[model samples]
Target chain A: MFRILKKSLKTGVATGRHPQATQSSEPLTPEAHKKASAFNRSLAIREVDTGSCNACEVEMNALTNPVYDAERFGIHIAASPRHADALVVTGPVTVNMARALKDVYKQTPDPKLVIALGDCAIDCGAFKGSYAVTGPVDRHIPVDVRIPGCPPRPADILKALTDIQERP
Target chain B: MAETKSCDTELKTAFPSIVQRDTTQREFSHFFVAKDLLPTIARHLHTQPGLHGRLALLWAVDNRPARNTYELHYLFTLEPSHRWVLLSTELAKDDRVFPSITPHIHAAQWYEREIRDMFGLIPQGHPDLRRLVRHEHWPQGAHPLKKDFPWDRALGRQQGEHRFHRIEGEGVFEVPVGPIHAGIIEPGHFRFSVAGEPIMQLELHHFWTHRGVEKLFEQQPLAAAVPLAERVSGDTTFGHSLAYCQAVESLRHLDVPRRGRYLRSLFLELERLHNHLGDVGAICNDTAYALPHAHCSRMKEQIMQLNDRLTGSRFLRGLNRVGGVALDLTAAQLAEIAAEIDRMEQDFSELESIIAHNASLIDRLEATGVLTERTAWDHAVVGVVGRASGLDQDLRRDRPFAAYDELSVKVVHYRYGDVRARMRVRMDEIHESMRLIREIRLRIPQGPVAVESSPRAQAGEWALSAVEGWRGEILYMVMAGDNETIQRCKVRDPSFVNWPAIQWAVIGNIIPDFPLINKSFNLSYAGNDL
Candidate 1:
């Protein structure tokens, strides 16, 4: 325990400043700002993997790690969709998962925003023409935001989350 | 090489009628066998003292319009000699039936079920004929892998329900979990039949992430398949791509430059380092030991950032190409990698000491989810999961690939297959991976990183490639088509075999500890589903 504490002190704060504050900031539209107001500065996200390769999920997990520390921004991954303010969906909606994705979206409380978390989720990405895929996340549910990368990096994810909610 | 020659002679003597199919690839020996004799051959290979074969992969290819037959290929990795034997059999297109070898081999159960699902090929007398990859919503009689089926054809959902294997008793009740999990993870359903605290039986229904990857491979050129392969399982991006590249390279007999081989091996080890660090932390996090988890996560991020600096993709995507690696490391870059590894190693030792001193953390890990050696062998489990259960197999040493033959790889194994054993294996392998990275840096030769060659895969030719991913062994079998396209590309992720073994391991263990045990194995659902 002493060794752990010593190591922790030596390492110091690993988390970086929110990338949104440092990176370019586009003016938010009034309509978009109204939607952002619903989150009330604190966002509870319920992540749904419709048919991802799991790279997005890895980055999502990294969001909670010491370096990213997503919780510092008042963002927490909720245990259930019912408690969530936003639905973070990844992957090209596979046929098997389309129904489940819809069910989770329905379970989320009203005024909930759906954010497509990766390239696959946004536009089916590399898996565009496959028969098993039911197109991207928007094909199954109404997507309010799209963070595009093969998997959007943790900093990008953090920036997007920050952009989605109104600044304090 | 001598051992392989003798093994070939032994097989020829055992089955005089067996037709040997010659190939330039030295890693595998192929043969055409009669359909009726396949099970007998499998039994002989599995039990015979001279050839203790492990059933590595079994996949079927549809040959319609061109030929009136479907081809079934069974790949076996032979122990002691470190060679692979591939047995092929042809079934008439009209009569798409073959004897199921699962009764004799046990390891061929999922493979047979998968073949039955994808190709509509019935395995005669198989115990479970239920769909493996095809879920409840998939329309009946629609086999996605058949050559006749269009890649972009649309089909409507049909009404059906998945039947979970039940444990019927007075106190038994089923607790079903996800195709959507609580945590940030992939989608898969788990049905736990529990009596009070202990689990009586566990049935896993995976493949929710099935994007028909194999079918998609046939729709594109050889060059485009690398990106598709990289996403076969997101975490195993390098492993899957490397296996696909190796298979393509073997098809053209293309030799990667010496420096390319060293760089590829180095990246492979780097992949291992990041994943192992994450897993060690994850297992601890599940046990509520947040200190090691936090430190390990920080270390993992460092490696990932290093990967981004070198390859532009944090997951090392686009690093592997058809003939060789796409990126070459400079001396300064090599030195940077070495320095980072040095710091990581020092930090990891301190973290290990912290974990070792925590008796409560060890208490939760020890003997929690035990997978016996017999069960692991029967299931043909690969990689760290198999090593923890005393399988004594590591493909880097058994059948060397890349620069592995040039550099000696120390295989790590443990006897008591439990959570603790799995953790120890990962920790030990972290050290081993770092050592390999150091060795590659020191002795890396000066040469072109890649070769200039037209990757025109010959028609009617196929080759198998395997890589030891951090999770386990990733295998890819590619058959080329007429227009330099893929006819059939079969991907067998370690998760596919290791996933079933988890069911066996979870038996008698309580509900809460499932996450820790599952994290220890950390099988990929997307990899298995694809």
Candidate 2:
């Protein structure tokens, strides 16, 4: 109790998880892609950083912040994996992460999309040809889409997910 | 860069079985060692109070002959002395048995097990030692991390695939989470056996995206390998690149210009601030606390925005080269960023206050998932997680590398070792970071950001460079080859030791709080995945 008070007094910042904020919408395009998103639209996403450089993962979290305000699109990060639809993966696939990635991918109901966000997931990028990386998506399991960048800018990722609503 | 002689002295004292001293470079020296003394030396060094940098990472480099030699590299850090000691132990093809350091350090248990399962190096005494980062059913023989391991092996014969282990019991039901999941998440699995909500055994199975960075890096020269090293952990691009660059600089006897060093420090701190902010939000979200999560994340995004405005890449990716940072902040831009950070700091201060003002938040976070000071010291964890538990092991201040000598970093250490303590440490560090950014902004040095670096590295030369990353100390050992590719490149992330402590921290906590506890650690799985 006392320590928390001391810390709060020092930094004057406590990481509280919620505030009274409602959802709003914004599209990368001037108009919505398909009137309705195919990606379990309106679904909340909880991200698992099974093993990522956080390059791609950061973008996912960025979706919620006011800049992008993915909540405006009615999308939120669910606390549990059971509530998410699109599993966004980053980093060159590492050996240790294979099983966990697969397990998460499988649990998401049939109509799910796995977005391999970043160069490492697309073709292992520069880290390819290593004895450790087994990712770049498409290798271990099926990847619906690949967002290529050493790390895609948050705007690029925002565009990629919004673009999904346009795809048949 | 030429090899230095300090490496020779270490190989001699730490591992006397070193048969050959290969010190051709003026920066660092390498030694070919006998296999017998590897574990014993590791045990000796763990107890050595002075020979610091407590074995940060333990992994093997594959020398792919018909009789493959799995070489285990243990990277250590000695406090107050910014020196890194990397010791290697090689095992023959059929003989992979080596004693585990888990008995002494407890932290090496996971690292040794990972080496065992990934590269086929066996650590005999590792308790709970099983295949980590590999599927349970992954075949025993075809270790993926070995040099001889081919990229197309899965097409030829399934090596270490679909090999996740299963727990067997009656009445105790098993719930298996995925290698993929319902979330916008990465690949990994968790097998939980529970009678009720209480989880009896939580076995985390990973290894979906194993690109084999260590072997692939060995195939390239240090100069060409810069791109691969940057991708080792995407969020840590700058951190990994800086560590690698430092190691090469150490070996080549190259000095990154003073301005270059300052820019590198700026970028590293930016990376730390960004990641720490995300974690603060993440841990709160795990507790179902929405307001703080939103605030913390917004603060994190602001940093990313600052990074984009300053460095042109939000994650600070592609901004690190061999010699120094690829992105340089101009006088105007640095000032603007410093101003922006000042604004962000104010918001951070306000948001963090709101969370701290809440009684329920502190009640849940304090004393929950406590890692006692003694256990933390014994494991020798680095960074804030360790610092939160009363271990004063900050590499920047203790070792005084780079601009750390010019700057003051009073690490805010706490003895409580709980989620609250961890968050407190993060808050303290962010304030510390805000001060740093402001100071650096005011004291911006005028010069080129990165100098041209491409020294003709010899095969025999090696160097050790250690830096304090957000998560903790990241050590790199680079052995330059004649052709410019790395003969040996080993990177040790702080998470290697910290992750195991997560298991211990989660020991008595209910499953629901696991996410909150885990988030406080905020370790990079990809950093450890390789």
Candidate 3:
């Protein structure tokens, strides 16, 4: 128990300043940056993996760790879509998961934002042209933000989440 | 390298009439059997003491235009000798029906169902021929893996409920979990038949995310297919890609450089480290212990950052090419990695001690979700789950690919196949992996990371590559096409075999302990579904 306390002290403060700082770091216009910070202050996210390779899920999960501490910014991953203010979907929308993706979109309350969170979700990425893939998330539901990487870094994911303003 | 056991002479002497041609390669033996005698040979190879064969993978290839038939391949790894024997038989396309080996082998259940779903090959005697890969909405006779099917074709959604086997009893209620879960996990439906809190049976419905990974490999050039292989399972990026690269390298007969082998092993161990750390944490999280989970996540993040610094990608993506690794590690980077691993080891040991002293955590973990050794062998479970159940197998030590041929690997196993046993196996493996990474860093050869050898299109040639990935043995079978492209690429992720074992593990466990038990195995849904 003493060792735990000592270790905790040595760890120090590991949380990062989110929304305001992450949004400001983005090369966005000041007006847009302000809008993003205002909108993302107390965001509740629901992560939906349509047909991912799971790299995106790892990075997303990291956001909650001590390093990123997404919870510090009120960016909690909700357990249900009904409570989610935003749906962060990953992977290329697969054929079998298409109905579930759409159902998740419908379950989210009106004025909810959908963020496409990988190369696969954005443009079918590495999984493109496969018969099982149903293309990008936008093909199934309207995506407000697109974070592109095979899997975007955790910091990049935070930027994408905080930079969200409205449905594009 | 290990001595080549002449499985050819032994097999030919045993079954002369059935074995048409038996050719032995460096790692495995390819045997061409008569179509009608496939089941007979499979049963014999499995049961006979001389060749105690364990069915590793069962897949079917759509051989059109050249042969006008479908070829079924049954890959088995023989015990004692540890030699692989690939038994293949061709079925005429007009009557593409073969006797199922599931009744005899038992592990061939899902594989036979998958062959029927993907290639339209009818496994005649399969006990349950429910659609495995092709979703229920897929129209009859619309097999995705056939050569004639368009790569980008889409079939509109079909309406109807697929039948799930339910237990009929008074007060036995059914609880259906999801294709879309509440947590940040992949899509897989779990239907549980429970008498109050104890689960009587658990049926899994996977392949919701099957993106035609093999079919996608068909469209790309051999070099371009590395990315697809890496994405097969996101967490297993390096392992899958390395296996794919090894398959191509073997087919081309290109010898990788010493440094390349060392680097590949280094990256593979790093991948194992991060995943095992995260898994250990996640398992604790499931048991409602947040302290160990937090520390493990912190340590995992530290490794992830180290990976990002070593390779360009955090998951070590885009680092494996055809002949060897894409990027070369500098001397300074190697030194830094050594130091980081030392620090990680210290932090990990501290966390392990904390968990060790906690009696409540032990109470929750001990004997929860016990998968007996017999059950594990019946399902042919691989990786840590198999090791925990006393199925003494580790491809790194047995097969020895990459720099593992040179380095000594300490294979960890436990007789008790419970959640605690699995956790112990992982903890031991983490220490072993750390030792390996340190050794590789110390003795890494000074040479080029890759060989300048262009892979040509070789028709009718096939190669198999098996790597001991963090989850288990990740096997890749690649066949060359007539047009300098891949004819077929069969990937058997360890999760493919381990998922069925989870059903048996959860038979007596309560509903609340399900998550803790599931996380102990931590089988990949995307890997299994694909």
Q: What's the TM-score of every candidate structure?
A: 0.98, 0.82, 0.96
Residue B149's C-alpha lDDT in candidate 2?
A: 68
Using Cα atoms, each model's DockQ against the true complex is 0.77, 0.35, 0.68
Among all candidates shown, the one with the greatest DockQ: 1
lDDT of 3 by residue, B161-257 (tens): 6789979989999999988787898889999999989999999988999888888888877777898899999999999999999998888888899
Candidate 1 has a DockQ of 0.77
Q: Which candidate would rank higher by DockQ, 2 or 3?
A: 3
Model 2 residue-pair collision total: 93
Off by over 4 Å in 2: A1-52, A76-116, A120-124, A127-146, A163-168, B1-41, B48-53, B59-73, B78-96, B155-178, B181-183, B191-201
Q: Write the per-residue lDDT of candidate 2 for residues A3-121, one digit (tens) a residue.
A: 44453466443332222222222233322233225553465555655345556765676676655776666566765556667666666655556655677677666566566777667
- Tens-digit lDDT track for model 2 on B183-289? 44445566666666766666666545555656666677676666667766666777888888888876766667777777777888888898888778777777788
User: Could you give the C-alpha RMSD of every candidate to the true structure, in order shown?
Assistant: 1.6, 6.1, 2.7
Q: Pick the candidate with the highest lDDT.
A: 1
Tell me the TM-score for chain B of model 3: 0.97
Each model's iRMS: 1.3, 5.8, 1.7
In the order shown, the chain A TM-scores of the predictions are 0.90, 0.70, 0.83
Clash pairs detected, candidate 1:
none
Cα lDDT tens digits for candidate 3, A102-152: 999999886677778888998898888777888789888876667778788
